[model samples]
Target: IELAEVVREVTKAENKPFKPMYDWGDRVEDKIFSVANKIYGAEAVDYTATAKKDLARIYELGFDKLPVCIAKTHKSLSDNPHLLGRPKDFLVTVREIIINSGAGFLVPLTGDIIRMPGLPAVPRATVIDIDDDGNIVGLE
Candidate 1:
């Protein structure tokens, strides 16, 4: 609820239209690269060629107005995951943009992002167990 209010405030403050999804289209990659370069001195590589065919196919199907969801490491604003904790001196290299037409978002592949979420070293499921009385236990 707080997030929703914040979004409302931000939208009103910015005076931007509240679109369900934002579509930057072909210029999305360049725009992001420019911003990164300005802010962090990072360089974004263009690997759109690899996904060119797929993107073209998506466009052919007429789903070109979808907003891009950039897939990058949360560890750093830059693409490099190892460069954690707001390091400013690094290049952000974008390898490709994977299109999810059905989901209506373009995933910009940056650095070494593992698309799959990995399990913790000690998974909680392992620690979770049931008591002899059938009550749930070990779920702190």
Candidate 2:
């Protein structure tokens, strides 16, 4: 039943149009800020000012045409992960955009993305054990 539900969700998503968070524009910074204002009623600031010299150095090396990876919370469309289930009347605050020219992507630090995957309240490792007969036990 769980597998069926998962398949159903995958099918639904597959049929949906690919709507990007930010639209394409002459400047990536402008596009991001505009999209943020339109959708989340907030501003997207370019926190990359500190790395201006480094960025200029990279640009001079000629690796500017790379895709961006916006690092946002998967739990919610808004920056606040606590706002669940298609929340309305909310704002998304974009703090920074980190450019990884070598990796070929700009990581936009929106809200907070969990860089590390966390263990559940009661981790399965606690329950999972090897039986005396050498069979795995305690997993549904």
Tens-digit lDDT string for candidate 1 (1-140): 99999988988899865653223654554545555666545644455465566556656776555666667887777787677666665766566767776686767677778798758899888878989999888899
Tell me the tens digit of each residue's lDDT in model 2 across 33-122. 555566555534444454355445535665444455557788776677888876665655556656676677765677756555657999
TM-score of 1: 0.51
Off by over 4 Å in 2: 1-25, 34-65, 116-140
For model 2, the local distance difference test gives 0.62
Point out the worst 10-residue segment of candidate 1 by lDDT. 20-29
RMSD of each: 7.0, 9.0
TM-scores vs. true structure, each candidate: 0.51, 0.44
At residue 11, candidate 2 shows an lDDT of 85
lDDT of 1 at 59: 67
